[model samples]
Target: MPTSLCGTWDMISNVNFEGYMRALGISACLRKIALKLKLRKVIEQQGDQYLVKTLSTFKNYTISFKIDQEFGEFTKGLDNRHIKSTVTWQGSKLTCEQTGEKKSRGWAHWVEDDKLHLELYCEGEVCKQVFKRNE
Candidate 1:
């Protein structure tokens, strides 16, 4: 088993996020606002269960799930969409697949060199976000 990625992470970089949001049908105004806001991720993991929280000055998104279990998920403050989501471990990476209106929508999270990395993808557009662990 891989080491737990359970901790607070402060965003260091978010690249191609606007295009990824656009691919998800987000409005121009929301995308513009999202670009300026700072984001943080808090992850709590116990065995196969996980609680992931995304927080920012403008909005917050939270989800809880178990590895390899599929559940209904609402994007809520992020995309405002309903999808069946499942997360599984691919080697050391935590990968998620979302089934909804969009095509090829998903994200993967991994830790490298004490940094948390995330890649969010939708409709061929990918957004890469890197976060530094908060000590």
Candidate 2:
């Protein structure tokens, strides 16, 4: 049987996000706020469809997409830019690619040891985050 990733996950730790924002050319002031943000991710997955929301006091981002389908995405509140986003599954892991002005911008999602792992990347920096499944 395949692993099921359907649940709410609360952010527990963020690693190397400062450099990730810096690589994305985020302003210093905004980077400071973004770095300190207590981000919460609520993910609803049914088969190959997904609705993921990233919430925070400073900004919120939501994405709705299907596996293996490429769609246009506008990053509202954060960056406020548009990009072509595509998500796919490599085994049980979910990988995404966002093609836009920024180089090598994308994210990946997977489960490890009952924890949700997210890796957000842009430019040359990668931000790793771990979240625990909310009961």
Clashes of each: 0, 0
* Cand. 1 TM to true fold: 0.97
Candidate 1 lDDT, tens digit per residue, 1-135?
876789999999999999999999999999999999889999997777799999999999999999999999999877899999999999999999999999999999999988999999999999999999989
lDDT of 2 by residue, 1-135 (tens): 347667888899999999988887778999888888888889897766799999888778899999889999988777778899999888878889999999999998999899999999998799999999889
After superposing candidate 1 on the true structure, give the runs of residues whose Cα lies further than 4 Å from its correct spot. none
The predictions' CA RMSDs to the true structure, in order, are: 0.8, 1.4
Candidate 2 local accuracy as lDDT?
0.88
Backbone clashes counted, model 1: 0
Q: Model 1, residue 41: displacement in angstroms?
A: 0.5
Scored against the true structure, residue 11 in model 1 reaches a CA lDDT of 97
